[model samples]
Target: YLVGGGQNHSNISGGGGQNHSNISGGGGSEPHVQGYKSQNKFLNKEILELTILLRNAESRERSLEVKYVALEAKLCQVESKYLVLLQDLKSPVCSSSEQSPAREVISRLLEDALDNTDPAEHAVFKPHPVSEYDVFGFRTVPEEDDEEEKLVAKVRALDLRSLSLTDPEVSVGVKWENYLSSTMNRDMVHCPELKALMRSGVPHVHRSKVWRWCISYHTRMFRDNLAPNYYETLLGVARDKPNPASKQIELDLLRTLPNNKHYSSPGADGIQKLRNVLLAFSWRNPDIGYCQGLNRLAAIALLYLDQEDAFWCLITIVEVFMPQDYYTKTLLGSQVDQRVFKDLLSEKLPRLHAHFDLYKVDSSLITFNWFLVLFVDSVNSDLLFKIWDAFLYEGPKIIFRFALALFKYKEEEFLKLQDSMAIFKYLRYFTITILDWRKLMSIAFVDMNPFPLRQIQNRRTFHLEKVRLELTELEAIRQTFLRERDTHTDAGPLCSDDEEDN
Candidate 1:
């Protein structure tokens, strides 16, 4: 029998009874059995706990793997964006196929017409040619020398205004017709086969048609999407923007077209229309938002175009023609253009560039408005309109050409400048005085090859790449931070629990 008490035993009395009757096995076995059962229970519990902990750790690792994979995908996407931008920067400025052969021929013809000609030939093209004979095509016969002198004196003495002058209405009509004919003839003469034709001279009567033709020509050349209802889409964009800059645009509405008598009045329909268009544009390009010089540009546009057309034209200009960043807050696009201008100065006028470097005269001092408003603020309205005509046809290159022409024209004064301030003042005010519209334009466009179309494209591309890379880096940093924060948050509880248990 087994004793259930501590340190007790029972005896087996059959064969071994004569040897010894010490039965302590029952008591010892009971305590030993109990200890073994308790140890087994503890081992089973520890194993089960370890298995659960391992499963949790594996789950956490799997989650982290998923997150890392997603982050890597995002990083790749950002890199790809930057690569595309880089590639764009490496491309050419303008494709040779942009202009048709006919356009090129027309442009060449226009250039030939404007080329150097004899004064007599130029006079022939003028509206009024001085004549030696009377208006009726009659030549008086000469008498004696003294009598001839007297006859000439008498003819000269006739009241200057009494020469059988046509009616004022008829005269005005005839003169205007002559001006129109003269302008058209000049334009046709300068026409080239591959480039857009420039409408030279004062196109007072043909302003609308000339503007429309230039716009159409560019639209075709750029293959810009001018689909039906595009204007409506633009208007819709205008209606959507409700930013603070829109208010500033409203305040400066009348001030924009200040010189235009029709739109100068406080409540004029033209002024209101211009306001609407500007405000709408402000709304449409909220990223650029509204800048100070844009109002001036829009105001100038109103002078040449109807409100609706002007709005669309401005949209085309900012979105397609000019560098995208030109109108933005940083004005980085203009800044880049200025950098290019500096490069141009260095190449074309090393002396001027050296002078500028010595004086520390940065291009930003005066070129901001030059590129932003296309010299609208500096040039006369009539001349500015003509520049705009060419601008519409050639894009921003016209502005660069115009700038180079200015530098070329004023190289003498610029070379002599003592300091940056003087250079700024000269560029700000003096350059305008020095330039003659026809002469300046002739210099700007005639055989000009300073900044080629390819270089411009490359510059734009380079800037775009830079922006993309910056954006990508910023996004990468942001994503990294976000991921770190998420990781910290996700592991916080688990770590805290582990620490407490430890």
Candidate 2:
């Protein structure tokens, strides 16, 4: 009976549900059918659950697709912004031909503003050739100061120069009094002649000796550490460093003092010495390493002075007058002086400044090397040396004065310049051509009283001592204070005896 029932049930399941009576013949019970129906219901419930999960997954996928599209749009916007920035970066912003109309008008106005003063009239205001050596001889003490005169006389009688050099023995009373007096008057009193000499140009022949004297006196006064070792160290550095600037220096060297018969020998000793000094200087100051116009400056120096004297003069000029950092790799000081030049132009030659501003002509483009190397490559070497003579006696102020003087001389042609490039080209060619050597030097150095000698000396000495001493003292004090503070901090707070009683 079980076998028969199994066959009948198998047949009913295999067939497409023929009849309920077929299952009854096999004794299939209502409970069995109910159980089968329950099984089918459970399978349907699982299928429904799977369908719901698939729909949820599809919804999540669609949401993710939307987010991805939004991100892609943002990426495309960023790329477009970057492309625009890149395009701008690649563009040349400062082409000279694109100068604004305001610049051209201003240039014309500046040219017109010049009084059309006769060059000869301008020359009349020019300083006569004063005796460079005795320029300050006429300086006098004020008539109103009798007591000061007596004091000065007494001080002068003490032979300060001899005493300063020899360290002479003195009576205790005198020694104490002099020390007090000197302490009160630490700065050297400049004679009237010296002041006049500083204001006027140093004659070319006397420049070398005068420069050496000035450097020696200042070195002794300031007790500069580098002064003693300077030339020797410079030579040693030159020997050690490779001749990196030789080719460039050589190229401009001959061109520097051209037309001067003194420098143009087939075997000129002066020229050779000038080359050596310049090379040595470049080696010594490797950060400046080498610049194009320095050889020209050295060559000009050699034409007027012997090699050793020329070197000393160069040392004084670099260390004392022009900005020390001007010749450095950064050329930062030149830029600063360029700004000062701009200010001078605006104040003294407003028309030129306005034209320059309108045309977008950066003063730096022309003036950077002018101030940095003191127009070594710009003007005639003879004129350059004369400029140097005045520069040494005066200070960096001569550079600005000369720059303004140059613009004043060249106002007309410069006004017609259409762009910065044209302006630079004009400066490179025409400006240097305006002044003959004598005239240029005469213009730059003669009749200028911008800086006092005492002030310049003081500035040199101050920088040498002040910053170094301050830093040293500050470090020492900081160390000691820190130690004391740390000790105090480490010691715990003291307990009161009254608290202990509690």
Candidate 3:
């Protein structure tokens, strides 16, 4: 959720539109100048009072959130203890002589319950459904490797002084900031100067601004939405309406960015903010409402953006950078893109692809989340920021370029690890391995290999047709199922109680 980097537009007439005539209108110039002054004073006072009330409510919300967390922990403890007691009851550990009749009755009833219950319900040891896409589902590192926390140690021990701001980078920051301001202030252009600077990386303090410019958030905000109060309006409408996707959104929010201080704990302001923005988006685009990896993308955007801006930037990615089909029930576009990536990797790096095949490693295992979340947790956070700087500038090709580049750089390590778990460890805990981000960018953008966008687009065209054909097949199957169901229903009770037909 975002939205606040003001620009001057003479027509905005009060944010310029039919939308806020009442708020911005001053009621016909000089004829009622004295009346206008009085009205302005009264309205200003009311606005000041409302602002204070809003602040107070937010403070109270913060306290309530803290209390909710404490209560939730106690609730979980009680539930766990109850489950253990239930387990003991299932085994009938205590003799009837030692306990009361009521207790014995409870135990006996519990035993009956366990006997009737599904085994899968308590099968905590059961493995997850294996997918080439799900690596975080497994415990990757071996006990010996984890004993030393070797990855953590390596990351901590590595010196990254070269990443510190240099004279040239600082100069670029100044130049980019001016570009950002001009862009925000509606001075839009195809600035080669700005795009070149963006490839280097954006400063932390100015990332939100840089991102705003990249997405043309200001332009979209005014042009497409047309309503200056668009974010606020959707927020109000969302609150009043019950969301079908609310439960899934809640679950994902709790698990997202658990280590990042901003989103570490549930019910924190950051969590609430993430929830609101995601829910608003769910409401904004019901067709693609609440996909799993979207929370990670929104969380990062929310960190850099205001509430509404985050929402719109997410839209930009899905509509512009990403194929709309990627986030839907079919996931046709994402799968096609995955195939495109795999083929491209084979085309560009035969040795690496062969190593992957030899180990029975699916390319999707590493690349899925890397692409889905735009490398949110896949790479080092600082490095992810660098990638985002380029991603927003260069478009989705940077993603493919970065993925291929990582494979190329880690070709040796990947070859050494013959097992899936070890390769998965290499992929999942990658950010923990110390990397020179500036160097990685250099390789991804320039040094490692060439990955032409036109070639990728050609692959994409073929994949899209394949997916559409699959979609057609799926729809036919669905229609066949419906016909069969209807026929079965009609054919039922051929011999009725009142009149039987032989």
| Model 2: per-residue Cα lDDT over 1-502, one tens digit each | 3455457557546542533555656755664577567546655666687788989999999788667655654543443343343334322432344575644543333222222233354422221111212121211112344543422322222222222222222233344344335646453234654544544444444555556655555445434656665676777777676777766667766665544444555465556786778777767566776666566567656655666666665666665666667666655455456655665577666888898888887777777778766776576333455566556655676777677677777777888888877887787666545533334445545533353445434544555455447658889999999998888778966568997799
Give the per-residue lDDT of model 3 (tens digit) for 445-471: 786466678988899999889878988
| lDDT score, candidate 3, position 16 | 29
- How much does candidate 2 score in TM-score? 0.45
Every model's TM-score: 0.52, 0.45, 0.62
Candidate 3's TM-score reads: 0.62
Residue 113 Cα positional deviation in candidate 2, in Å, after optimal superposition: 37
Ranking by TM-score: 3, 1, 2
- Cα error, residue 37 of model 1, in Å, equals 99
lDDT of each: 0.59, 0.56, 0.68
Q: Which number leads on TM-score?
A: 3
